[model samples]
Target: MNTAPPHQQAALLRRYQHRIHRVPRNLVVQPTGFCNLDCTYCYLPDRDDKTPMPTAVAEAVARSASELVGGHHRKPLGLIWHAGEPLALGRRRFTELLQPFEELRRKGLLEHAVQTNATLIDDEWCDLLTEYGFRVGVSIDGPKDLTLRRTDRRGRPAFDRIMRGVERLQHRGVPFSLIAVVSRENITHPDRLLDFLAALRPVSIGLNIEESEGVNTERHPPTREQAIEFWLKVLAWSRRQPGGTAPVRELERLGRYLRMSRTQRADRAHLSRVDPLPTIARNGDVFLLSPELAGITAPTYNDFRAGNVLEQPISAILREAHRLSYVGEFLTGLEECESTCEFFDYCRGSQAGNRYFEHQTFAVAETDYCRVTEQAPVLALADTVRKERTT
Candidate 1:
């Protein structure tokens, strides 16, 4: 559909000569998958283990992270506390797990963040979050009725509990953000969702389009037209708001495509490639790229693991990631994508999960996500931009 003339495509390609920025160091540590709520669309359901990473293992992982960043000129590596519910580790143990990273931060080795469901946040948790400079991103679907589907394993509604925790954070003046997953049931009600988020007044809101992953395989993604309608309404609502905290709308492919077209680079607002962003699992196995890779363990082979942090140094993991044929091939695919496609300057290529789902290999390009997010939107944006320029 992106049938830009050859001359226009060449001009666009020439405008984007700079290389994509590569993240030097970062780690997502899954302290535990012990979440209190069982949202219907959770991608981490396979990680239902309640086993917490031992203090020693946490320390080892932190040390490895520090070393990796240090080797890369001490770039600010983000240490994301990811999990079923990282807060489920309880206050004391969570603090213990973070102490090593805190020490690393003090030494200017890395930054820290936490992604939680916010059901357990209290004054004490908020205090810790503020004290440690942890950027909190809470998971909550729009209003109470919509969020009721977020229940415990035993099917108990968790909206009130999560809101109570969110209130604690707000009352304590702890800096936090929100992550909402949009589903078919909620796609047509962007105003209602935006109203609810505006009331929360979070620092920013990230809206994720529902995808078929983990236990969420049964969930239905909105049609492309539905997605476009939802995002356009959200954008219009955001522009109309007077003093309300504007939502970021993370998965709005149109905005990303427009930004990419104008600037000749992919918007880095969403998650980056999984290779440099490691996910340290419960058993100390370090999975390069994404936590999704951890759920892909086969009985006969163990290819996802870069190495065990407890047994190997962080440098080894980085080196191993660089050595992965998939990593090299994936990067090449991105380069090829950039060179060949008229929309190349605007896309970061396909996500690993999408690639795996569509092609069964990480190195292959995912045409589905590309068409829906990059190609179609790029054509639409170019038309708008060209018209504006003409006028």
Candidate 2:
């Protein structure tokens, strides 16, 4: 646990002032609310709805992008198509959805990516992916035994299907990345996970600790010991790589944070002004800070919607985002995190969705999500590097 001493904690809190610098650097658009697989741990509430984003809603999103992505942004906005298996929308319908953003892409205002189960990747899908120059991300949990939880509607394992899709991408020569969920079943087998990832050969890898969020109330969050051991194995594996560990997202983040000077670490500008990371639903409703919160219905929080783009530009919603009840409550949580957590400089705060799902409110700090994802990894990596320097 990164619990700062009292004097330093007070100074840190004074610096950040508990303000969320809301910036729209990325847009996560749900092309549809249907997934082909019934992964046991999926948090999406409407995975079976099969409702694709209306073309008009997509057009509305694009129209609003100018306001969100224009002006002083030095890089193109990241437009990620995710949630409920984006590929389930089908190629033609998916193409139609992408059409609205053609101008944005051409104008260099946006870059495209897709987070998919990879069970739908065929030559045609690969063609579409290549045509758009997408940064493809496959959601695979490792070999068959580890992925038994990821299944189709009839309860058939999707491991083989997912691999076939991966094979298709490799055969088509498309570069890609992988995002794997780390849970109880797989947390103790870091070597197995790393070996599988090495064989698959994604350009990069991101490990998302299994979370208790939205509809997935039953979660087996890894123990602190399990998480630390897992990350240490990953860090060691990464160290042995001749090139570097940059491919492992978690280790890379740890390295960068550890390398920062104390002054740089203390600089709260980047930490406090985290990208709001708006996730737009098929209906044009926007969920800020956390994409996982999209499409969830919590009557107490107005379904966690900042606003619907169909009604107004996302910029307008963002401009008034601080006034939204949940957003305000979340800011209060940040104050708590800054005042207490020694890892606040590195983590900023837990995701809004995690806070809400775990505690049922945004005005709280810390959760199993942060412990396994943030604290454990940081401690593991930092201890490993320090030991290495001394040795």
C-alpha lDDT of residue 51 in model 2 = 77
Clashing pairs in 2: 2-342
The segments of candidate 1 whose C-alpha lies over 4 angstroms from its true place after superposition are: 1-25, 71-75, 247-275, 299-303, 332-336, 339-341, 367-391
- Can you write out model 1's per-residue Cα lDDT over 129-205, one digit (the tens) per residue? 88888888988889987776689878998888889988998888887889887788787898999789878989888
Total clashes, candidate 1?
2
TM-score of each: 0.82, 0.92
Query: Best candidate, TM-score-wise?
Result: 2
Q: Which one is best on lDDT? A: 2
lDDT of each: 0.69, 0.83
- Model 1, residue 265: displacement in angstroms? 8.7
